[model samples]
Target chain A: MIVVEALSKQFGRFQAVDEISFEVQRGEVLGFLGPNGAGKSTTMKMLTCYLPPTSGNAEVNGFSINSQPLQVQEQIGYLPESAPSYNEMQVEEFLTFIGEVRGFSGTELRRKVGRVLELTSLQDARKQIIDTLSKGFRQRTCLAQSLIHDPPVLILDEPTDGLDPNQKHEVRELIRRMSEERTILISTHILEEVEAVCSRALIISEGRLVGLGTPDELLSQSIYRNAVTLSVSGKSAEALLEDLNGLEQVYSVERLEDMPSGALTVRVFPKDRESISSELEQFLKKKKMVIEQFFVERGRLDEVFRNLTLGN
Target chain B: MKGLFPIFKRELLAYFRSPVAYVFIIIFLAANAGCTFMLGNFYDSNQASLEVSFLFHPWLYLFLIPAVGMRLWAEERRSGTGELLLTLPVRTSVSVFGKFLAGWAFIAVALILTFPMIITVHYLGFPDNGPIITGYLGSFLMAGAYLAITSFTSALTKNQVISFILSVNICLILVLLGWGVLSEILNTIFPVWLTDVISQFSFTTHFDAIRRGVVDLRDIVYFLSIIIFMLMTNVVVLESKKAS
Candidate 1:
């Protein structure tokens, strides 16, 4: 539903978004991962047509953001960073105003506003003035207005930035429910948010796309892939490590500290792209060595993200 | 036009949503009455017409209009609703004109509330209603012009105080161009025709024409042109901010 091509935004000597290109199809929720000053907000602003890109542009739902910005804006429901809203307005009134601007009125405007309020769980606070609402409520009110038009694409900047853990989970579930038909691009510094809600993620740093893939794909690229940790009894870790080193797929083996229960812990590193589980099991059976714990670990995404964005 | 309706409604409703509109109205009514009776000496002049009240409008609007217009754009920027308003599927003209109209309507409300003085004048004697009606018209037009200038200054910065001060300075200069002493000082160095043309741009000159019971087309057009010119500048300012 959205395509950005070689889009760059430079402010005098500083480049905020540098020649970054990406596409998001309907039903895809793309997580934008970056730290502070990483151009996440700037990229979303360019996409929303809030700021014109210094060069190049993006298209939303078949409309150029530069040439047909009004049309592009009609199709986008942007939740700017900090979720700015008119503080003097009541929540219900604000949503109605947005609905009216989106070309809905009378029964239609009422119905759309009602629907968004329900979706964002803002019905109870609808009567309260925006400035009087709590931060979580205010954020949800922002979310409500973005949905007031039922746009095909949503660009949310830190939707759950200051929410409590429960509120964050609720918003995540809401995004998940809405992810079936809408294309969503949400930027967040919270790594686990990508793991929880995004089908694919793009990690940007220093105004460049550093990593782009499914969470699992990026995780598998970590150095920890195919590494195994084992706890065994009836054998010293030295003996186990020595035997595991003799296996063909075993790249290396190291002994860990002894467990509190006296079981020796050892870690086995398999050769690249190799899985030695079955062979190691058979070898253990042949030796009659009892195993306490055996775990073949998946790579940690946090470790992968840190290496991708900050390593370079 | 349809797209601008909601923005206009929201902006107009914003004034009433807070105490700013009420406080402004009360203070405005008192100030207008004070300027007419205390400074213009309306009763002492024994003027059955609203000439004294109308005469002080330009001076009163100099400060009052800017106070109302300063927050029109600066508050939006400070509160971050600039993003919300600008991202709507409306053209820059729609937003700019909508907000300008809302503020102009507010100044209209303040002007309309001076009806008690009008009633007083009519009850005191058979006043020439023609002059009074055109006087209010000129005052309203001059207000629209001053408000347009204030709106432009407001768009230049996010600070309300700076917006107010800048607008007051600009409005003061525009007002002073037609002042007697200023013209006298300028006529010493410049040609008489040049001085006349320079003073013609002042709001006071056109306002004076209308206040004298003559609603000339050029005077009306002059006030409207100033409003249009400033709002066009407002559009450029808003657009250029987005470009960077």
Candidate 2:
């Protein structure tokens, strides 16, 4: 449903979005993960035809953004980073006006507005002024406006930025439901959100695509292989570190200290753990090291994100 | 045209939903009425005509029209709604012209409210209603032209004050071009034909022709050309933003 080729945008001497390309298929939820000022919003703006790209081209629903912007705009609904709205307009009035501008009329416009308000859970706030609503409600209202036209493509920038935890969950659920029908490109910094909702993730840094893969694929690329943390007490920290480092299957080991009497926390990176766990058990028994706690430390999505982004 | 009507209706509703249209109408009517009755000496002049009342409109619209036009685009920029508006399916010219027409229509409402003055003139004596009608037609067209220019200026910046000041400055230049002082300066430096060409561009010349009850086709075309020209510039300014 969407294609971007070598899309670059420059403002004076600064390049906001470098040459980046990606495609989103129909009924796919693609998460755009990046830190602040990483060209996420700029990319969304170019795709929405709000700002023309300085180089290359972007097409939505088979229409070039630069050549046939009005047609492209007609097919895509965009919620900018700020989720801007007119404060003086009531919820229903604002949505109706947007629907009318997008070519909905009479019973169709009314029905669409009603459907979107219910979809965004903004039905009760329909009569309230936008300025009087809470941040969460305002965000929902912004979402309602974008959905009123029933566009096939949705470009949502930080759709859950200001919502509470429960509201965030509701929005995430709503997005998951909506993804079944529309092509969604959602930009956010929340790593867990991608794991929970997105089928694919695209990580961008410094206006460049750093990583793109599924959640498990990204987690497997971490430096630490599958290993367990063994808290031993009888052996000194120095001795445990020395013995773990000398093991043939051990890649690396680090001792974490809490206090003189506390259990030793050791993170072991194993090269070949199939035979190493039995060997380590026998060695610890012979050395008479008291093992208090042992648990396998799985790589987390947050750790993967931190490592990937920080390493670059 | 079907696409244009929705934008026009939305813009008109927006104006009324806030205090913008009301405040503009109230201040416009008050100032226009006060100037006609007190400053122009409507009853005291007793010339058996609305000439004095109609004469004051050019000066009134000079500043009042900017108030209506300054927010045409600047508020959208300030509120971060420009992206939302620009990304809609409607063509740029359609939206720009629709918005300009809405502002002009609101100003026309305020102008029409001055009918009491017309009634007062009709009650006192026999006034030439032909010139009065054409004068209003000329004033409405001039206001549309000025509002279009102001709307174009508003799109250039996010600051409404700057938009107002720039529009007033540009309108001042156009209003003053055909005056004796400007003509005297131009007559000394340029040939008589060049001076005449320059004077013809001034709104004052065409407006004067309509105020004399002539309704020349050339004057109508001149006013319309200015309106269309300024609206086209407004579209260009907005489109340039998308490019850079």
Candidate 3:
């Protein structure tokens, strides 16, 4: 549905988006993950034809952004970051104006406006002036304007920002429903949103694509190694650490704490699960340490993001 | 054209929904009426035509039209709605033309409200209606030319105050070019032909020609050319901004 190639945007000496290339398929929800000022919004603007790229090109639905911008614009609904809107206009009037500009008229325009209000759950605030609405309602009004045309692709930049938890959940559900028919590319820092709605994720750091895959696939790459923690009551932490360090499968063992009752919190780093669990069982038996709590810490998307972005 | 119609309707509605259009019309009419009747001695001068009323419009529009036109694109840029409007399916020229026509229509409404002066003149004596009609036409066209220039200036900046100041300064130069004070100064330094060419471009000169009951093609073409030229420049400015 969308193809961006070598898309780099520079404002004089500063590069906002640097040579980033990616493709989004139809009906796929792709999450663009990045920190603030990471060129996520810049990339979306190029796709929406709001800002021309300094170099390279982007295509939406087979139309070049430079050569056939109107055609591409006709097919994409863009909700820019923070969703700036005309505050003086009522919600319904704003949606109607957007519909008219997008080529809907009369009954079709009314129907489209009605459908978007329902989809964004903004029917109650339809008559209220946008500036009078709360922040959540105003953001939904921005979404309604974008959806009024019912375009095939949605470029939502931080759609759920500033919303209460309940409103965020409601918006996520709406995005999920919209995703059944439309191709969506959402840029967000919320990792849980990616896990809940996006089918694929693209992690960018310093204007470079660091990782791209499903959540589980990215987790399994061991960008975060499997590390287990054992709270044992029968042995001293120093003894446990010494014994665990002698095992072949154990990469390292450190005593996190030494309890007054002679218990210990030992953090064990292992190469893999199969090798470490069996080796630790045998090694702990020899050391006579009774394991109280033993659990392996799995890799979280947040950890992977921080590790990749902060490291780069 | 289809896209332009809706934009035109929306812009016109937006004008009325706010106090800007109403205040603009009221001030324009009150000033035009007061200057023509009280200041210019309309009835006491024993004039049987709209010459006094129409003659003061160039000075009125020099300031009034900018109030109507300064917010045309400047507000869009300030509110961040320019991106939403420009990225839509409609062409840039359509939006530009639609906004220009909306401002022109409001000016026309204000011109129509000056009908009381027309009625009062006709009530007193038999005035030549030919010059009156042509004068109204010339005034409306001249107002359109000023509006087009203001609209172009509005697109250059996001601050409405800056747009208003810039437009008033430019319009003031255009209005004063043919006057004796400015022309006399120029006549001493330049050739007579050059001075005439410069003075002929003044909106006051063309408006004065039409006010005399003479519908010269050259005067009409001058007003039309200024309107078209400014509007085309408006379109080109917006298009080039979008390109970069």
Candidate 4:
């Protein structure tokens, strides 16, 4: 439902977003992962028709952001970074104003407002001034405004930023619940949010697109993928490390720190993307080594994100 | 155009929902009344017309109109609400016109609340309704022209104070350009034709012409053109923010 074609935005000599191209299909939640000032907000602004790209363009629901901005805006709902809103307005009044601006009026407007307030769980704070509400409620109010029109496409810039853990979880749950019907592109620095909510992840750094794939696919790029870690108590650390390295299936082995209880932990790297845990287990059993703990690493997103976005 | 009504309605209501509209109206009435009675000496002038009252409008609007208009775009830009507003399915012109009309309507409300001045003048003497009515039309149009300039200045920056100061200075120059003493001083320094042309560009000249009951098409066009020009420039300023 969204196609970004070599989109580039330049502010004077600094290139904010440079030749970035990606597409998001319906029923897909694409997590935009980037560090601070990685042009993530810039890209989302261009997609939402708030900022004009200097060289290239984007399309939402087949409407070009450059030539058909109004039509594109009509089809997309956007939540800007920091979740800005009018502080003087009440929660319900603010949502109602947004609903009116979105072309709903009369009973339909009230129903839409009510539905979004419920969706964001802001019904209790309906008549309360937004300025007096807590940060979580204010963020939810802004979220409610974005969802008032029920647009098919949502572009949220840091939807969970500045929220507490529980609020973040609730927002992720809301996004997940809505993901089945809408195309969502959320930019966030939190890797766990991407893992919990996104079907595909796109990583960018320094205005360049570096990694794009499913969470598992991106994690596979990490060095720790398919690696085995074991904690032994009876064997000497050096001997176990040497023995684990001698095996043909084992690529290398490193002795991890000794635990407080005097147990030694070691990580074994496999020669390929295959299970080495069983082989290591058999080798330890033959060596009369007491294995206390063993598990295979399924890879980590943070490690993958760091590897892709490092040195930027 | 499609987004005009909602935008206008929201902006208009926003004023009343806060202390801005009430405080502005109260201060405006007090200052206008003070100017007429204390400074212009309305009772002492022994005039049957509201000319004494109309004379202070140009000066009163220098600060009052900017107060009403400085937040038009500056607050939106500062609070990042412009991002939400512009992203709506509306043309830039719609927001520009809608916001301008809202501020103009708000100043209209403040102006209408000064009805006691009219009642006092009529009760005290048989005032000529022609100049009184034209005086009000001239004041309303002048307020719009001043507000358009404030809106334009407001869009130039996100600081409301800076917007207010810049527009006040601009309006001050426009007022001084056509004031009697200023024009006489300039006439001594420059040629007669040059002083005449300079004075013609001043808002005071056109507003004064309208207040005197002449209602010339040129004077009406002058106020309207300034409003249009400033609002058009306001749109350009906002649109350029996206490119930069």
**Best candidate (score: DockQ):** 4
Name the candidate that leads on lDDT: 4
Q: Residues A22-86, candidate 1: write the lDDT tens digits.
A: 99999999999977898999999888888999998799999998899899999999898888899
Model 2 over residues A1-312: C-alpha lDDT tens digits? 899899998988888888999988898889998878879999999998888899989889899988998889889888888888878889999898889888888999999999999999888999999999999999899888888888899999999989999999999999999898899999988888998788888888778788888776776666543666788887667877898899888888876664356868787787743325676777789889888876664446777777666665
> Which consecutive 10 residues in model 1 chain B have the weakest lDDT in total?
B1-10
Tell me the tens digit of each residue's lDDT in model 1 across B1-244. 6578898899999988879889889988999999898999888988799988888888888898999999988988888888887887888888889899999999898999999999999899889999989999999999999999999999989999999999999999999999889999999999999999999999999999899789999999999999999999998998887776
iRMS of candidate 4, one decimal? 1.0
Clash pairs (backbone) in predicted model 3: none
Clashing pairs in 2: none
What would the TM-scores of all predictions be?
0.95, 0.92, 0.91, 0.97
Candidate 4 error regions (>4 Å): none
Better of 1 and 2 by lDDT: 1
Q: What is the C-alpha RMSD, rounded to one decimal, of candidate 1? A: 2.0
lDDT, residue B83, candidate 1 = 86
Tell me which of candidates 2 and 4 scores higher on lDDT: 4
**Cα misplacement distance, residue A78 of candidate 4 (Å):** 0.2
Show where candidate 1 strays beyond 4 Å: A237-268, A273-293
Instruction: Order candidates by DockQ, high to low.
Output: 4, 1, 2, 3
Interface RMSD of each: 1.1, 1.6, 2.0, 1.0
**What DockQ values do the models have?**
0.72, 0.70, 0.59, 0.80
Candidate 4 local Cα displacement, residue A294, angstroms: 1.7
How far residue B143's Cα lies from its native spot in candidate 1, in Å, is: 0.8
Give the runs in model 2 whose Cα sits over 4 Å from its true position. Answer: A224-243, A257-261, A272-312
